[model samples]
Target: MREVEETLAHNLREVREKKGYTLKDVVKGTGYTEVSISRWETGTRIPKATVLYNLAKFYGVSVDRFFWR
Candidate 1:
């Protein structure tokens, strides 16, 4: 639910930052727009499962790690 979505966003944002990627960089990696990345980081919208999977894969992490502790 909302908590899981928030966790996903938080983890994705953290991982992106740890890797020194700007939102624009993530957008290029995910083929999602910079606005979409911003929305996710800001908790404005939860990304689709496919988008999440692509992001996790792009970061070389499992989908489980993207949303869970």
Candidate 2:
């Protein structure tokens, strides 16, 4: 469980970097605060389903990509 969460966090950060998006950009696109996004990236907080969906849509990736390899 912890491993999965860490993977998710790592993937989220990786994807955001790959897309050249700043925390502010994600905040604007996902309606989540920069602190929340930072927490998500650091594995300190897990996002709810709706937030995950919004992130996936904003990043142009499937939700599964956050979990699966």
Candidate 3:
């Protein structure tokens, strides 16, 4: 689970950077608070399944992108 969370955090940051988006940009795109997204990216908090799904969908990524090894 810790590995998954860490991977999620890395992936989230990477995905956002790959798209040249700031946390504010993601908030605008996903309607989640910047703080919430920040926490997720920092691995201080994990999103719920629904929230994670929404984020992946908004980013046009598969949910599997958030997990590995």
User: Which candidate ranks first by TM-score, i.e. highest?
Assistant: 2
lDDT of 1 by residue, 1-69 (tens): 788778877888998898888988887777899888889877898888898788888888888877666
lDDT (10s digit) by residue, model 2, range 1-69 = 999999999999999999999999998887899999999999999988888899999999999888865
Q: Which regions of candidate 3 deviate over 4 angstroms?
A: none
TM-score, cand. 1: 0.86
Error of 2 at 4 (Å): 0.5
In model 3, the worst 10-residue window by lDDT is 60-69
Winner on lDDT between 1 and 2 is 2
Sorted on lDDT, best first, the list reads 2, 3, 1
Cα lDDT of model 3 by residue, 1-68, tens digit: 68888998988888889878899999899899999999999999988999989988988888888784
Clashing pairs in 2: none
lDDT of each: 0.83, 0.92, 0.88
